[model samples]
Target chain A: MLETLPLSLDAVRDVAKECFDDGWRLVTMSANQIDDAHFDVIYHYDKDLTMKHYRLTVPKETVVPSISPVYFAALLVENEIRDQFGICFSDIVLDFGGALYLEEEVRAMPFCKVSVAQKQS
Target chain B: MARTILPFGPQHPVLPEPLHLKLTIENETVVEALPTLGYVHRGLEKLCEIRDFNQMIQIVERVCGICSCLHALCYCEGVEQIMGVEVPRRAKYLRTIWGELHRMHSHLLWLGLFADAFGFESLFMQFWRIRERIMDIMEATCGNRVVVSVNVIGGVRRDLSPEQCQWIEEQLAISEKELKQLSDTILSDYTVKKRTVGVGVLTKEQAYQLGAAGPTLRGSGWAQDVRQTGYAAFGELGFEPIVEYGCDSYARSAVRFRETLQSIDLVRLAIARMPAGETAADVAGAMEDDTPKPVSAGERRDIMQAYNRDKRHRFVTAPPPNLDLPAGHVAAKVKGKPDGEAVTRVEQPRGELLYYIKGNGSKNMERVRIRTPTFANIPPLLAMLPGCELADVPVIVLSIDPCISCTER
Candidate 1:
């Protein structure tokens, strides 16, 4: 019956903490850059007792904050967000570069990139 | 001081889709699994901007081939939420019919892959053969083999005749017999039990919290099914998520196999109870010149609400021959002017799928991001792999039914 609809960036950690504490493991983190100025990242939670959704937004060009320290699943989704969108996580376990599936050419397209998307300056 | 980094698949033999994962394995155990995705982001959100709401279903279906109809289902549901259109009752039942049919085939396909994972050629071959019957039913009812184009904004594009319904029932009957045999063998077979049982156990508690969706979560003793949302015409119909509590690979297989049988029953029920009604809505395009107008939020909500009524639908909402999806919704300036952004989540076949759509109300979307199930479920996979022998990786991974395309798409 509880729907998070859309959560704020400041509340991202609190929601993740509560969801994880409440026994809902973080499944995946989905993100997309709205434009050059803003980015939206969604943390998907999976718990038997609860079925709901939550999200957070960050500045598109800002340095990456590590959610992986709190949730491991966050790392995979982060890597994907970085690759497609070119947003870089400041410090983490892996570099998470290269086209996991896409090719060099496809990666160059604006639409082909993702949340932590990177474009040549 | 020593860790082996192994790159597994973008196009490996075991994997059907192209997901490149780099696993830091120590002594055959995964220390860390780094997944590299985004090979499949086809700019669907941007495509949404260029393509009118009507053509979006065909585009959305291509997002995930395995769950093509469901992709359309989620998109329609999302749009319908914005618009407030009410679809007819008959269209809802028919949508359920195709949706269940898609679930059965997808699970059957995964079952075959699981069997193949352990090199059980006979079981693999047998399971796949039965899947063909379901595909035949799909072709008979919808025409296309995989993309089924059954979802339109207002309702389905076609309806089932009495004879077609009877034929579908008969084929489902045949599929049930084979699926039952398959489940029996999977449950009692020593080889399968030896390989799958107790392997990759994701406790019910774990399944729910992880935001896992579909059979993967359900197989682990947790009930997380999207059909319960009753999108399309599911509100009038009755269906349950096929579940198992064994929390192992075997149980996962059983959940899918059993669900295949359930789908047959559901299809029979839908066909038997179907009421006659108009399959397509009148959607005609009335655009004389390239005139652009800002669509009001109220209009957007109405359009999405209308779509909600058409959820899980297999028909297309054709704007009365001349008038297409109002150019108002298309050329209209949105609230954000590319300032506002939103994320969309749906229960995909594998698990929870997230699509982040950000628009600038421009010709192209500002950004589009997706969170696929495999990427999210990878953590549990690493947790399941540490103690198991390297041989079990294939089966355990297969249990999740990772469609790297969805992850990348």
Candidate 2:
């Protein structure tokens, strides 16, 4: 099991800055739907093959601060989460605007377990 | 000069897969590059919800053809770790052998494609020709060339015999000799160096900052290879991550070139030290029809012709006649459904392939997030592309060994 430090939506950037200052390479972020109303966005970091994880349990309606400003590598993965989970992120460096993998006409989160109607609400 | 947006690929002649980049160019030099993905996004991560955990092995293998064995190995290792299953010693060595063979072939294929990208047709053919020997070894040993589905939940489904090991060593000897013959052309030739040496340079800082993996990172003087993490038999095999300090396309190609020979040596080491034991745990069955049918003269000629005509010809050899376990026995015996999470990382030919698996104590897994090496290398590719010439774009892109199928998956 992955042992992750829990973070609120507001603490994502501060924790990411700490990781950057400590010479951690941003490996990748994995986002999975915890429930109909919450998504667990896990930020994985690595330095010298040792990994440290920070997970933010984000509510569906909340807009999480993007960590791409601290680590430029986080932009692509953050955009990917937005495309797959219907979660919004603010101030991504290269914001694909949720079009990284989804077409504008396709108004569905293909990765979500809940119904599209329920997610939009 | 007015800036122009030159769209490169989605269907460019140089790209082996569809990856479009909108390059902002001013007077033949790229000022900026913005990539556009999603031409082939299949949403394979979503399949974990529908397919059972056992069935997802085959699906994950399809994520990338060149490094398919590593994909299966990574997924199986994750599932096994989650279930707390200890894979057998021999099975670990077997996985290492097959995984390195996949790396060898994948590197050779990329070298051939990189040659083709720069218009070196004969050099391209030469690399592919050498790669065919590895393919033949795979076909004879594991029944398929590209997607050799030998990995199971707890261990491997296939075991190498003494005779097969000897034959593989002989084949590797020939490939190594031929590869050394072409090293001058690949590494020091005037034309090859003219195009590759200083093109698309990425410093160690840029590579690490932008999250490069495998040869891309190593090419930039960072010896970061997940294989050093000691997955499978790598810890026992005396492995070292190959590093080249050129920080250019040449360095990346050189890293892969040197790694091909290293993989051959690693396979030899694994075969010599492989312990004799059951290939898989909890496997119980008898030998059933483990014979190879004799091919007639006409069929042999036709097979040879098709194989020579096109490398992608599906060489329809008989399936490997190993492991005669009952259909449902292997799955049923591995204990209950997985209830924990596992973060598995394997060094693929392209780079580090990561899998984040979470199970909900059900048949289907809750989440299987694959962070492919190509996916991590894209940001580095973007960093390298901005200062290169339009003519050098293909070389710079292929230097990263982009696998669009794996990236999109």
Candidate 3:
């Protein structure tokens, strides 16, 4: 049977806190936008030996907090979402500015093309 | 000491593709290095939105010339998860056999190039020559030197005949002997050791923290490998990740050299345990009894309209009888849908490559993103290079086997 570890909405920060304070090495954080209300955040953590995958979901505007200080990799992933999609991090300060993929003239922030007028513009 | 920034590539003798990295050097030591990417951006993720799942199989194979099997396997595993299709054991073994062969060739090919970079022409030729032998075997089986488009949605595209199977065993046996000797030579060679030892060390803590998988993390005393996850026939045969602990350039080289032996062993094990049955998975033909019916008429008409409105890629009927797909997501999230999304990780020759597929529920996918191993490994390179001398950069980079094309793809 397929297994999954479900966490409550309020437990998001605590989950990151346990992993960050523990010996688990924070590997990655992939925030997948399911829809306007559903956003799945897949937290990838590993130690010297084993790796763990933790998934948490929140509403579109719901800020579940950032694991930046706990796991540095999460910071980059969060920034990628900000740059690619327009998902705002509550207080995380990540320096991800620069032309990583798209050109300068074609909208600086994420979700630029997602808008119809901007896409046609 | 004075510091200066020297640009290394996008165009350099050591690197093949366009990977421009500027290194800040103080005397002979590099203080800081900044790497800029995306010169070879093909927007592959965007391309997938247009191509259907079946055609995307062929396109994903082109993601990287080497270790294409892993990409296809990851894609298949993702698709299989969505479609809820279980590949037969025979096909799993075939996946293992070809996957290991690809690993052996990729490592050896990287080894040859590394030797050439160090001006060791003879060693370079020796390794490349052995790699070519394996490449020839791969060509005979998969009909391609680099990108072998063998993977399909349900299972494999080509089934190996008895003669072809026997040929693979024979080729691996010879390659095994040559690789063993090469490993010995590489380990003991005074110059190879002198150049590689104590250069570019990624500590155990550093490796773990940075999320370096496969040989990179393994070289740093961590034996973690995704193969143990048993994606294919890996579970059938006892497959352990080849690991080393020294955590330096020599340790990295030794780890790869040892892995070559491991890959050959795996291929041998796979061939010996190979079962005789239909290697082909039926694919589209298997849909009749599949839990989810192929795509439904109503859904197809709606999705077709969505595709037409996009003015990009749309699914077309193959003719004869057009099957309807069941409502809700038919396959696993990896195969993608118009509504769901998936992130699949596969252990490539270098390390772990992650594929994130987001579906919008239409016939065509919405967005397909990839986070390659090389992109992840580059940060560690920043950490690894600072302590090492300028001369060792080429070998260190080569040891990681940075396929800039794979990263940019």
Candidate 4:
């Protein structure tokens, strides 16, 4: 079962840090394009076979704080979200500068609905 | 001393799939390795926006050819959970049987490839020869060797008869005997030990911090496996997670080898305790009399011809109306369309595969997020590569059994 806790961007770092301190494993991070302006970023944590999800809603241009400082594995998922959705994370330990998955020739943020809409227009 | 840059594959003979790694080497030791992917990216998650939940199973199965069954199983489970449909008991047991078979085949394939990576050509042949028998069983039972599309939203799409089950038992016994002999050599062989022992070591703490999964994590002494969570019929079959504490390339390979044998035993147990009943649930509000009628041979041939003529087009659309589906194929039917989100996690052969599906009370899903095992395992692979010598790169990479198709999907 998955439990979603909606938290402000400010609370994300604290919640993530607490989860890390409590020995929760960071499973993976997922980003959904809720709209043209807002995106939902979910951090999935697993402990003792139970899954807890922290959902943070941010605008397109917001630079979310990196959780890699807490869980080192978050670097990969954060970089992947940066590459796919064009969501930037501040102070990533190993920043690929948005070149982790996609090549430069491909349009930025291919998974973003806003980009698709813009392309259509 | 100057650092030399070595680019390892978007295409390399050692790699079965395309993955690019830029290794910065100084005096034959890798200082750092940077990975870049997307060579085989097909934008499959994006396709979910157009295809309905029912049609998305075919696409999900293509996420990784090696662990195709688990992909479909996870996706179907998520959708079924969303619709609150309880799969039939018999179907659940059958899914366990087939899932174990797929795991065995996949591990054997990985063992064969790993053997070849270290130039054990004869061992490679033996492992692959055993794998072919498993593939034959899959083809005979599910009709497709690689992407066995036997999972529907309500339950599985196929059943095993008693005679077929007996044949499977006989084949597994023979393969198990052969694997026992192979494992003896793999574990004790001097050359294999020299190459693998004390090489590319990942301690338990590092593995956890790096988020390694499957055998990679188990090799470092972690007994974490999603199968223990009791999805499908694993809860009934008494599954156990295999682990090793060597924390080296050898330990990773040994974990897979033992897991393959364990899967064979699980299949045997599943067949023995097989439940008797219908193989699929007539989902809520579904037509009770809308049973699928078998297509004629001529219609089957025509459909096959069309499928071959334009395979890419079929990737984007639903299966043809008059296609000859295998027996026990059930069209997913539900009381209402999926309106909320659900997350499903399954133990793929490589590691944990997670799926997040959200629907907006329509035929088409709003978002489908797949966090495949290889995608999560990449950071760990990169973390292990930096301290190793150039010659050990391929061995360490193959030790993770990286599935690039799954990663790029």
Candidate 5:
């Protein structure tokens, strides 16, 4: 079962901290492209067997605060989102600076539709 | 002491897949390790935009050759949920049977690899020999040794005959006996213990915080399993999660070793309780006069209309009459494309695999994200790598059973 909670960019850190303090395990984080300019960042957390999904929508250039301080495992997926979607997170503990999975030669934000469209055009 | 940077594998003898780790070592002790990936990345998730939902199953199954069935199963279940298709009970049972068989074969293969990692060549050969029997059973039942494509949306694609089931039972019994002897050797052998027992320790807290799953979490004494969520037929089979408190490589190996036997038991239980019915619901046909009628043009047109309208409709397609689907088994089909999002999680052989799929009421999917077990396991592996001797790197790495294909896919 999943419970989706709407969150703002500012409240994400506090809410994530609360979840972490509540002994919730960080499952993974995903960045889904909603449109050309808007993206939805989902933070998945699990406690016992129930999954809680916190979702916040941000513009393409918005800098989402890093949740790595609350959940260390967040660094990997956060870096991945940065690499694949060009979503930026501030103050990541192990920041790869958008070089986590892709190489330097590969074009950035391969999963973002806008970026792919721009490259194709 | 000067720090030496050791580049471990875009190619390595012990690693079956390509994983490059930049290990900074001081006097043979790894002080820091950084992993660089993408050597085997096929961009499979991105392929979802081009492939329709049906074709995505074939691509997802190839995510990891070892956990192929679980990937297809997870993808199907997610799509089925989105379409709200009720699979037949017998199909669920068959899925459980094949799933456990896959787990058994995967663990046996890992045992062989783990033994080889520690230089136990004889043990490695013995484990692989036992694994071959399981492979033969897979080939005999599913028509392929690896990447068996038995799972489809709403239900499975094939059924096992009574004779085939009995033959599988016999083969499992023989393999179990051989595995019992091998387990004794593994536990008692000093070399195996020396290499695995206290190396790469991960406490329960660390395991949970690191998002470790499957035998890795179980080895650290956590009983969390996605199977506990009762997906597929595991809920009906009285599934129990095997766990160990050692929090070390040996504990992880023992967890996997015991799970192979547990999986065999699961298969036996599934066969004994196998229901008498059809393996799939007709996805594009209707029953008339106690006979399945071909999908009418009107119905097909209605389905197309529904697709254009962005409405969900169920359809049925009957399997070939001569196949194993028992008489009176009806198929439940989805008439149009899925237009919603679903999150499906399945416990693969390695760990908990999650698939996030979003459909847009068209033939093609909008987005698909696969969180493979190995991908989740990488952070924990990095945590384990540091503070260990350079020589123990391969053993510790293999202890997690990193599947680069799954990770990069």
Candidate 6:
């Protein structure tokens, strides 16, 4: 009984702004790497204990726009997705430069099954 | 006037966990605070790829020491939902009892730590002294003090006898009376109030906008708790979320203190109303014939391998003959691999703990994403840090009840 609204990468910012203006709280975001080339990212929002999810499929090379300006709480989870999936986010309020949890030398996403060398090449 | 940067923690007198925060201060007032984590990151989520869905229940229990039972409950609930398994009513009530016991102990531990954060030595000892009673209750019921691995996908592994239930009530009565004795000091003492009453104020608007959960949200006058969703036996228990409008550290402390008393009442109610029946649903076909039968060669091999893998039971050399597999052996086997996905939320002592589980009709899960309560509360903690004095940093940090281990996991 999980419901989600399909969203394009371009519509993420607009939906976030709409949710913020209409009194919705940003709950959290979760990302799943579907394959080596694609990832599915979900944004969860809440109002009065009711939750809504907006999901978009992104290519690994795509840079999703940051919603941190609309919801400041999105910064941390966004950085976490960046570190874990290697999905770049643009215009984050506080960018950890992909070192939020990993060291600088740890260049690969630990969550992804592909080897670091395979991912880079 | 130039701002000076001070690095706090990774190791500090006030914090037992390693949470490093860089505080930029002008004179005595903090202008900005930046948190750096990863000190205790164990990459536990990745283990799901190797561990089967059944063993992940024990894995999630290690997420947090204080709320281990609730974590296991949440994971089991998620998997059950995915597989369309209905937990029995008696099992639901049992989960309620153990979950509340964990809440009581976690709050007591936090209260002791909160007291110690402000240099109240004797009060710290007093709170933990009462906490031991609840730990004893858990040990007596579930056989382990902290990580009571009693929750299975279909139901609970352990059941309580009537005598044991009566004994738990007696122990809880003693703990409740002792806790009431410290109420006046914790609520109205001049020093306790001065340090916490107005120290870290988070207004209702700011709290909601920043995604605060549990007591942090309730402490700011929001009647929002995941328990209200009635995942377990709470639906029948007439549960109501506790709210305090003080919007400060003291408000958060009062919320937790009052909740400890609420948990005691809840445990007693769950036991009294528990129905008499089978405690768990027979997910596997093993429950059809309960007679003590000789172990089959294939099943015996599986048991030996299981015993070898389990570190706690590894001392045993071989499987015993005519293994009397008890009733409610729900953990022994599951019908088939779970397919599809489920998102389950449980009300942990800290706040709402969420699990996103996906199974592709395989032993290994496609993904298992955990969103701990501490992760959501960090932004609100950051909002409260600025405009506070340097000496009050620990008071504000402790207010959120940050579990760095849970967060970094």
Whose DockQ is greatest here?
Answer: 2
Each model: TM-score of chain B? 0.80, 0.89, 0.85, 0.89, 0.88, 0.89
For all candidates, state DockQ relative to the true structure: 0.37, 0.78, 0.29, 0.57, 0.52, 0.73
- lDDT tens digits, residues B154-174, model 3? 667666766677777887888
Model 4 C-alpha lDDT per residue in residues B1-409, reported as the tens digit of each score = 8999999998887899999999999999999998878788888999887677677999999989989999999988888877778998888988888888999999999999998898998999999999998998898788799999999878877778787888889989999999999987789999988889978888888888777878898999999999999999999987889999999999999999999999999999999999898788866622233333454577546655333565555466643223233455554445556667889998989998899988766767788899888777787888888889999998998999899889878
True contacts kept of each: 0.53, 0.80, 0.22, 0.53, 0.53, 0.71
State how far residue B131 of model 6 sits from its true place (Å).
Answer: 0.3
Q: Please give, for residues B1-409, the per-residue lDDT of candidate 2 as tens digits.
A: 8999999989998887999999999999999999999998998889898787888999999999999999999999898887777889988999999999999999999999999999999999999999999999998778799999989888887777787888889989999999999898999999999999999999999999888999999999998899988999999988899999999999999999999999999999999999997778752222233233454577546555333566686858965434333233222245567777788899999998989999887777899999999999999999998878999999999999999999989
Q: How does chain B of model 4 score on TM-score? A: 0.89
- Model 3 stretches with alpha carbons more than 4 Å out: A1-14, A36-40, A46-52, A55-69, A74-79, A88-94, A108-113, A116-121, B282-343, B358-361
Writing each residue's lDDT as its tens digit, candidate 1 over A32-55 gives 554556766666565542446665
DockQ of 3: 0.29
Q: Give the residue spans of candidate 2 off by over 4 A.
A: A116-121, B283-332
Give lDDT per model, in order: 0.65, 0.88, 0.70, 0.85, 0.85, 0.88
In model 4, which regions exceed 4 Å deviation? A116-121, B285-335
- Candidate 2 per-residue C-alpha lDDT over A1-121 given as tens digits, one digit per residue, 9 for 90 to 100: 6788888877899988988898899999998888888889888899998888888897776778888998888889988888898777889999988789988777777888885421221
Question: Just chain B of model 3: what TM-score?
Answer: 0.85
Error of 6 at B245 (Å): 0.4
Error of 4 at A51 (Å): 1.4
lDDT of 3 at B176: 82
